[model samples]
Target: MISGPLDHFRSGYVAIVGLPNVGKSTLLNRLLSTHLAAVAPRPQTTRHRILGILNGPGFQAVFLDTPGLLQPKYALQQQMKRQIDLALKDADLVMLVLDASRPDPDRGQVPPMLSGRKVLAVLNKVDLVRDKSSLLSEVDRLNKEGAAEVFMVSALRGGGVEQLKAGVAALLPEGQAFYPPDAVADRPEKFFAAEFVREAVFNLYGEEIPYSTAVVVDEFKERPGRKDYILVTIYIERESQKAILIGRGGMAMKRAGSMARRQIEAFLGRPVYLELRVKVAEAWRNDIRFIRENVYGSDRPSGTA
Candidate 1:
């Protein structure tokens, strides 16, 4: 998958699709060498299709980070699934990342989204698999099932990533760059601001709450040569859950805010003043109006992004 000498620019979208907890975000981050997508050790942490762009000499890989395909329980989950489908429809190439460390899928069974489109099966987290021979066999099995290629890589340990990158680049269609070479992502600062806070919530909170929660950046203002101030609201469904997020003496909320703010500052390349507040939305996941207001608004902000 090496580039040729009489080089031409290769730029196209590559969709990263997989089941839950398969390190799709981590893989995209490693590929781009940037924390453009939020990474957490929780299932379905990515709620929308996030784009992480990798621009190199003669190439720009716009890797789309899609939510894990799963059964929908609420309107929000349905939207997430729709995002995945849309990504598949638009991608020039598809990287189907599967957790090599996890329990094997039943023989002859396949992921539902394997229906149409050209895909490269990537066996991710290979470092976690103890039996190397078994892992190779699994990869070979996937290659037989319509994948144009199969790659084994550890997204965390940086194992076999170069090969994966080259494979992805080779699969992309020949075209002009969709975005500028310097652009790492298409998302605005506020989107990452909310996602960074959500990542902290996933890391700190227990089951159900993290999945139920969503963050909205209410206000973001910056003064030249001065610090930035950002106000964000953490949304949940129940009052008790809101109390849990706040914790005793606001300790939990403070910790989450502090951790997220540090990451935000690093991302912004300046000091940041972050303010977080929690509110109960009473089944926002099921409410289409609420989804239209907060989740949809935050995810698809107007203008170029």
Candidate 2:
């Protein structure tokens, strides 16, 4: 159980896990009241664990937003899945976010993998449902899954968030504040830039294009007065993929850059001049070198930044 002053305590990590498109990113953003994580309408929009920090007078809670759970399609995917594994290793709490608007065949079932952890089943998107009784029944069903607690919340509307925050704070183990009271997140600036670019790609393109692509920020430099300058390369698996990203007279690229720049500016709270270049890495997702150099590079982006 949490150990610290009732109103002034510091804390540990909480892992938010769920299926793709279940509103994990939305929840994180609301909790932090900041755009620390990129939000896209696409499934698997989050490909890495982004940290969102909550600071109080005497407490701090660090939340880790993990990629959606799915079967690995390549080495990159397998690596992404590993982020969830790492989160489960020593988490102070695990939040299993399930969509209440949809039925889960495994709804009431708890995997043995979580047998020893403190688990909370969050029935998300409650506002989307028409009947509260049915939602309650679903909650009851999940209660049988070994979750220590249950919370029905609509991440989009900020419903029940205060209660959820209070509950989470109550569960924190006693310790010095893990981070400064004002720290909203732990990620480097470049990571957000990369994610912003990727989110743009996801929204601009349909189907395999979003999933098949990756973005790496090669340069992020401070400019005199115009704006913060960013240069990023969009990596794709094949040359044919390159054409799709570039488009005729670079219309597609222009759309992606423009869309992404707005979000980047919002996230950074400054004008951003985002420059994007498309390249073909020839199946980088499956190539070890590609994954090593890009996805899991030594300067790997982490919320713990």
Candidate 3:
């Protein structure tokens, strides 16, 4: 634990922002010491803003794992951008996670929202770098450019994570804890259930199939002693895509379900009876009403499709 003054209990929101596939979600999970965010090698795997509360002896870090920054290609992508924007606007501190192994580390520009705020530049994937001098030079360049502080860490291997947490704890303002110590994340189990299914799709499929796919939990029933029952609907835009997801003799769907069921069961700490079905939604991503209700939840007002 990152120890600090017990009288000064600090708490604040820290938004993890970066370009796609920069290991933003992976870093969040590492910081929280648990898997609260879904991660994959593909870009744009995280579409929603996930809140992970990290509580230690005298500090609470409310970390927001947001969708990676990207140009809006469709209504769904636009909604994802909205999630990023909202996270930036609400954050007390911004942690910019970057892939340090990239050839042109200077290409990663800081967002306009982080202009005057306390920004922490996190150079992730340090384990991939062969030369330590080059990594130090890149860190110096980033710190000289704008970052208030810079850290080199390998999120996958838990390297330099404790120091990063200590740095964040020092920056956090004194206040009350936003969430209870035991709480890991703010999202419900059903939300993670849907995310687990979607993650499986991304891992199993190839090409544009994962990008066009979305999973919705139709039914989630929990029993006292028996295994929990879950019914999920996988939405796609075309009939051909549906056929590809289902596969010949339903083998592909079976593979996805088997992978997702094991993950969901681990997440919920119970056996899961998962049922999957594919349906063609005919460009549901372009429909504002559907995107608002299904993707971002119905609580927010519908925007232009």
Candidate 4:
């Protein structure tokens, strides 16, 4: 046991987990006060374990924003599950973020591999619940299920977020900081470039296009007096998909590249020359080896910044 008041500093990993489309990424972005994780209206938008380090006055809470836990349907999904498992194994505490707007989502059950760990139930999207009584009932239900604590907040609107942050700090074990104050994420800008491009793909197309796509930053070069050069490839499962992405005379690919470049500029606070290409990788989603080495290269694409 920690004995002295001087050892009051707290630092630990908090795994933020939930079912698909529960606003886990939104909550991560809200907590970090930055867009470190990718967010979209679609399920399974986050395919990696994105870290958000919140260095506060007395404590440092490293938040691991994981992909939604679900049954693995393909190699990509299986890898996503592996990422979640990694986070769960490393977590000092588990924040089970659930959507308050969803019907009967307050199960309050402990997630897999989280046995005997401190779990704080975050009933997010409270703003969507017009009936306050039902929300209270959800809280009461969680209490009955032996939750460590239940925090209500709207991650998108910033309601009740500060209180939740403080509550999280109090539960973390006392230790020194793991990361410096200036650092907000564990990933490089090129990693986010790939993610932002994928997000743009999600935003642009419908049906099976987004799911069949994987983005890789093939190259990133900084110029002393010119726009930074970024070369990216959008890997699709079929030639037909590539045709759709490229569109008439490459207009579609140009549009996605332009959209992603603007987002990357905003994120990096600098201009970039983005080069986008689409390639056909047949059944790559089912190829676990390719997914591991190429797409998720050390949590980023291979040979990239």
**Every model's TM-score:** 0.94, 0.93, 0.94, 0.93
Q: Model 1, 61: alpha-carbon shift in Å?
A: 0.9
Candidate 3 segments whose C-alpha is farther than 4 A from its true place: 1-7, 298-305
Cα shift from native, residue 96, model 1 (Å): 0.2
lDDT by residue for model 3 (1-305), tens? 34455568889899899989989999998998877788889999999888888887689999988898888989999989998877877788899999988876344556675788889889899999888677777667767768877888999999999989988888788999887889888777889999899999988999989888878899999978988899999999889898899999999999999999998988888898999999988888788877877777722342111
The total number of steric clashes, by the backbone 3 Å criterion, in model 2 comes to 4
lDDT of 3 at 216: 88
Stretches > 4 Å off in candidate 1: 1-7, 106-112, 299-305
Q: What lDDT is obtained when candidate 4 is compared to the true structure? A: 0.85
CA RMSD of each candidate after superposition? 2.1, 2.6, 2.9, 3.6
Residue-level lDDT of model 2, residues 73-105, one tens digit each, is 888888878888877764798888888888877
What local distance difference test score does each model get?
Answer: 0.83, 0.81, 0.85, 0.85
Of the pair 1 and 4, which is ahead by lDDT?
A: 4
- Better candidate number, 2 or 3, judged by lDDT: 3
Query: Model 4, range 1-305, lDDT digits (tens) per residue?
Result: 12223348899999999898889999999998887788888988998888889987688999999889899999899988988888887889999888888885435455655657788889988899898677787778766665688889999999989888888888899898988988888788889999999989988888899999989999999989999999998999998888899989989888888989888998899999999988888989999877987678856432111
Q: Give the TM-score of candidate 1.
A: 0.94
